[model samples]
Target chain A: MEILLQQIVNGLVQGSVYALVALGYTMVYGILGLINFAHGEVVMIGAMIALTVLQILLAAAFAPVLAVLFSLLAAMAVCMALGYGIERIAYRPLRNAPRLAPLITAIGVSIVLQNLAMMIWGREYHSFPLPFSSTSHQLGGAIVNDVQVAIVVIALLIMSALMWLVHRTRLGRAMRAVAENPAAAALMGVDINRVISATFMLGSALAAIAGFMVSANYGIVHYYMGFMLGLKAFTAAVLGGIGNLRGAMLGGVLLGLIESLGAGYIGDLTGGFLGSNYQDVFAFFVLIAVLILRPSGLLGEKLAERA
Target chain B: MSINKSALLVAFGIALAGCGKSETASNPASAPAGELVIKIGAAAPLTGPQAHIGKDNENGTRMAIDDANARGVTIGGKKAHFELLSEDDQTDPKTATIVAQKLVDAKVNGVIGHLNSGTTIPASAIYFKNGIPQISPSATAVRYTAQGYKTAFRVMSNDAQQGKALGEFAARVLGAKQIAVIDDRTAYGQGLADEFVKSAEANGAKIIVREYTTDKAVDFTAVLTSIKGKQPDLLFFGGMDPQGVPMIKQLRALGVKTQFMMGDGGYTPKLIELAGAAAEGAYASLPGVPLDNMPSGRDFAKRYEERFHQPIQLYAPYCYDAVNVMIAAMQKAGSAEPEKYLPEIGKTEMDGVTAKIAFDEKGDIKGGAVTVYQVGQGKWHAVQTMGGAPAAKP
Candidate 1:
């Protein structure tokens, strides 16, 4: 029972980050009808930027909390600008071309960003210097650290804010309008490009937070860290119903739980034939099962003709 | 549509032409007139997680070549201009094989690396088939030399030796009755863990649980949580510092206070730097004595740091020894060609910075040493040295 609780806590912490990154994918997919594959790189860039800022501040003997706050804001601001720039430069040129062009360009942008990060940060894994030490709390035979708790709380708050923005605001209504039909939204006096760009910036800000949470929790960051994370978050978005905001959140948490529990108990479940190393396999297997059983995902609506 | 098709064809044609030009450019003619250019190929993971150690190995090899050139050695009555051709194998077995073939195609007189056992084992075959001698500075898997490949040699001790030392230390010195073992499933990690388990069991320490992960994986919570339930006395990991640092950190975070121990892969300054306080009291074993204790180690490390602007991570000294040993074999045989110096390597009896270098029949270093270390005060302090020849009089 204690092991189960521990795995659940682990899963939740990991899943929260996934959900945060998945929001970026789902939001862009919802508004622009294009999967921003490079969103993961944006997250990596955020962590790298924040790390640099934190290093400088801490070296200058700045207070830990204040340094963290400054770094977080810098990361979010840069990522917002980056999100706006990516849409403007890469997607805008291919907006009128074939759908495949933009999709391929998203992947191209992801690769370009990864190489650029490599050149900037080098390939060595930088140990994230934590300003504050992680203090553990005991909870019914399971242990939870301060950083884990912070990650969960911050992710929830960000996610809740995103939910409120997309549903309860004028910009949210405009975003929904753009998602419904670009031509119709334009006729309705919705600036399609601006709404789309806002969606990306909003999602990217969430990505920056996710990146910070990941580096803080894992205590390590590298240029290639974003690739696997991006892939997993994409899987989460698809599992939750790609364009559905709530579905992305649900999928991310579920995927995280499945991976953690599978990794924890796979040895016994298979009578020791398989080990916890098959943890990644459990995630992809769940994805395949979901795709086969429910093509539209658990909460996804039926396919609608876009053209 | 027709215009797009033509444009694509033209682009494809240009790409093919570009490839052809680069291929020819890479195949430079050997022996540029008078000076005999002795090309030595060095392979390591130059751009990935292990790149730090790989770069160290490359730098060590480059330093040896530069030193040899400055001294201007004569090989077979020709003034040899030593050239170092370094390639990034990216720590992948497939990439290592491709790199091996590329080096062989370039007709390198000798080769010095492929840092990981997973890579060295596969690439060794290519070097053997091409009649090129190869020396690995860090690969410790017993399977490497056990393949009976005359072309394969290593400066460091094999896993069998290091594991024995680690197992004995864990069982006898640490007095851990129950142990849990984990490996990254790489050739080096798995082999080292297997050897440790065997030796530990023989020493009466029961291995309660065995878990495996990949080199690329960062999360080990599930593995740690599972191990936590068992509550072993000590947890031994066999993997590089990249995975090792994170694993130990996560283990500590989960409140699993089992004593942590790892092999040479975890014996680096980066491990301490990355793991922070979590690394305190953690144990690691490395082949050969501590760098400060080796003959001429202090001088070599000082020169290396002066040149590279960084402290030696791990294996740089071994790499330095391997290159010098290979060059010494060439100098002894009076020829840079592999066919001439290949036999001389087996008969080597030179004193390297790391050890009194000599290879047994199997190309394993004669009496190779292994030193166990524990991190305290944010640095590794050597606790004991096992096997190998006794420390020579300074």
Candidate 2:
């Protein structure tokens, strides 16, 4: 029972970051009908940029809080800029072309960003400096650390803010109109390009927070860290009903919980044939099961035409 | 316009080739009379996470070549000029095999790496088929030499020795009755863990839980928590520094308080730097004497620092020894030809920076020493040196 509680806590922390990253994929998919496959790379850029800033600040002996704050802001600002540029230069050029073109281009952009990061950061694991104490608190027999709490809380806050912006704001309405029909939205003076660009920036900013969260939570970062994470988050987005905002959150958290719980008990269930090391298999297993059983996701609304 | 750009690109490519050729041409001893240039191929992961260790090994080989040239070593009555033809295998098996073939095609007399066991095991066959000698400075998987490939050799103790020593150390010295073992499931990690478990059981320490992880994974909360429930007193991980650092951090965060131990993969300064205070009291074992404790290690470290501007990493001294041993065989056989010197290599016996360099019948370092270290005061301090003999159960 204690182990289950511990895993639940672990899953929630991991899932919140997945949900945060999934939001970027879902938002971009909803607004522009593109997967923005490079969304994961954007998250990596955010983490890497923040790490560089933090390195410099720590070297200068800046206060831990000040350094973390500045670095967080830098990561967001840089990733937002990158998102805007990526949408304009890569996705925009192929917006009216066959969807496959943009999909391939997104993949291309992801590879280019990964190699660029490798060149910039080198392909080694770097220890991420934590501004706050990593000490855990015992709560109901479960271990909870400040970093995990911060990740979960910050992710929730970002998701809430995103929910508000997407539903209650003018940009959100414009984004919704564009997602409904780009030609019609343009006729209605919705400024389709602007909405798409805004969506990318907003989504990327969320990814930036998630990037910092994951880097801080694990206390390690590397060039290729974003690839597997991005794949998982994309699966989460799809599982939540690809174009549904709330579904992405549900799917991400659900996937995390399943993975944690599954990994925790797999050895016992299998009588030691399989072990916790195969935990990653649970995420994909859930993905495949969801895709087969509920094509539109648990909360996703069925669309007559697929994006 | 396209034609002109194509022409310009061609010109640029040619100019780059010429520039490369010029540097080689500038080498003072290239094809000089009475000088037989022997190209020794070195393959390792020079570009991935393990690149630091790979480059360290390459640097060791480089130092050996420089020293050999300076000594004007002769073979078959000709002054020998050694050249290191290095390639990055990128820590991948397919790449390692390709690199091995490329080295053989380049007609290298002897080869020096393919660092990880996953890579080295596959690449060893390529060297064997071509009758070229290859020595691994860091690959410690027992299966590496067990393949019966005469071309395969290593300068350090294999995982069996290291793992048994670790298990015995934990059981006898630390007196831990309950132990939990976690491996990354790679050939090196799993093989090491299996051996550790065997010896631990033999030493009367029962392994309570055996978990597994992957090389690239950083999250261990689930696995660690599962192990925590078992309440094991000692937690051992069989993985490299990258995963070990974070695992240790997570373990401490969970407040398990289990004594942490790892194999040679976690035995690096980088691990200490990454794990921070969490690494305090953590134990790690290396397959050879600590670099500082080696006979000529101090001088080699000073020279390596002067040359590379970085302290010697884990495998540099072993690599230096491997290279010198290869050259020694060449000198003994009176030729730098692989087939001629290969037999002499098997009979190698000389003082090396890492040990008294010699190989058992299986081509593993004979009676290779294993040194167990514990992180104390922010540094890995050698606690005990277990000689080549396997630890006896007490």
Best by lDDT: 1
Q: Report the C-alpha lDDT of model 2 over B68-169, residue by residue, as the tens digit.
A: 988889888988898888888988889999989998998999999877888899999999999999999988899999999999999989998988889899
lDDT of 2 at B91: 80
Best candidate, TM-score: 1
Q: What is the iRMSD of the candidate numbered 2?
A: 1.6
Grade the docking of candidate 2: medium
Q: Taking the tens digit of each residue's C-alpha lDDT, what string does model 2 give over A1-307?
A: 8888999999999899899999999999887778889999999999999999999999999999999999999999999999999999899989889989999999989988987897798756678987667777888999898888888888888889888988899999898888888888999988888888888998899888889988998788887788889989998988899989999999899888888888888887888889998888887877898899998888888787744
Off by over 4 Å in 2: B1-35, B389-394
Clashes of 1: 0
Q: Could you give me the TM-score of model 1 versus the true structure?
A: 0.94
Ten contiguous residues minimizing lDDT sum, candidate 1 chain B: B22-31
- What's the CA error at residue B241 for candidate 1, in Å? 0.8
For every candidate, the chain B TM-score is: 0.92, 0.93
